[model samples]
Target: MVQQRLFGLIFALVCGLLAFGSVNAGTDGVTAKQAQEAEFELGKRLFTKTAVPACALCHTLRDAGSEGAVGPVLDEIKPDADRVSKALRNGLGNMPAFKTLGEAEIKALARYVSQASGGAGPSGN
Candidate 1:
């Protein structure tokens, strides 16, 4: 009787283990917060990287510590994310369309600029 009970227990444990192992579940990949941080970092790099013209070269942003006089002061303009994104996508006035940047890069840059300029909500509203 004791041997039978021990065998039953072992079988149950093995079955439970197999069931747990066979169950497929999606993994918790990088969180939204992590993705946002990564995007912000990439945006910052794109803004100031040497290979590109660098937004910092023409705009003044406290975060970037850029004091460029050619473009409107980002600190004063404090444009929303949507506004910034549109400008980057289509350009305006003296600014040329940043067609080279990918959509994702442009979005990231807009979010970064808006957030740094005190527009943190969605669409920087």
Candidate 2:
């Protein structure tokens, strides 16, 4: 149990770090497998649907089956829940604010982007 918690913590921390560039990253530990899957599901919904200005219209994540290159490749960004949340909340460089999205959905998007990256836990600056 302790080991699981520790691994979760590490995963959360890594996700946060990668997602936000360590800029006031918050609320990690959202790494349960089920949660991750749910996040992926939500992300897919957001990506394909136009209701919330689908991500596919701008960015690309091959795993999500999108090839858009308008914005940075989401899969390459390596964002996690917190980092993803911050971006949605703040509207980074060119990605407009998705402030209407609730925290859960935003976190789900983060998880979706990070996991889809097909990469290990967050690393680097």
Candidate 3:
């Protein structure tokens, strides 16, 4: 009877730990998702802001709901993350280099564009 009680106690402890771990994991998952959503919103803001000749100014993106006619249509081009990052970093064609945007901003923008364009991240993330 003592052994059975001990076993029951152990089982209860283990179950409690497992439940606690599960709750912690769920919280972490929610936090990570919230952070990602915030990053996406920031990228969208960067893409649409006028302070830096917004990406939306020249490109048409369905996800961004942009209908710009100056540059290529981003929805049709469907640029990968790397291409978007490279262009943001080094500029392309008639586009001038945007050395002012921080690296994190550039990465966020690249990720946003890749995901919005219906492609995976730069290298499938």
Candidate 4:
């Protein structure tokens, strides 16, 4: 009877482990590089389409294929992530504040711009 209980406990433990593994299976295969790429892609999408008026409408970014004449050329300026975040949140010069975007969205956009323009530090907002 004790052996049967032990076997049952082990079986339960194994089943629980299997269930947990399956639950995390989708994320277990993703590499750090893949996650970073996904983040960059998300930022690109926000820049081109999700943001109000769209960053592509006023910013010139070769990576995004935008040829806007209003904003400064990102390739030349290469503003860092913090600068981009500040400008996005509070507005800078002719740019309007993007109050609609959340902190995560701002961070992603900042990272994307900083990286794409060869700016230093893709750090947080």
Q: Give RMSD to native, each candidate.
A: 18.0, 10.8, 15.9, 14.5
Candidate 1 Cα errors over 4 Å, as ranges: 1-29, 120-125
Task: List candidate 2 segments past 4 Å from native.
Answer: 1-35, 119-125
TM-score of 2: 0.61
- For candidate 3, lDDT tens digit of each residue in 13-91? 4434544664253654434454456557656877876317788888899988899888888888888889988998898
Model number with the top lDDT: 4
C-alpha TM-score for every candidate: 0.71, 0.61, 0.72, 0.74
lDDT order, best first, reads 4, 3, 1, 2
Q: What are the Cα lDDT values of the candidates?
A: 0.69, 0.62, 0.70, 0.75
* Residue 17 miss distance in model 4 (angstroms): 19
Candidate 2 lDDT, 1-125, residue by residue in tens: 34423444544555555566553324443434444564467666666563267888888888778887788887777666567667788998988998666554565566567677754433441
Model 4 lowest lDDT segment of ten: 1-10
On TM-score, the candidate that comes out on top is: 4
Ranked by lDDT, the better of candidates 1 and 2 is 1
Q: Decide which is better by lDDT, 3 or 4.
A: 4
Local distance difference test, candidate 1 = 0.69
Q: Judged by TM-score relative to the true structure, which candidate is superior, 2 or 4? A: 4
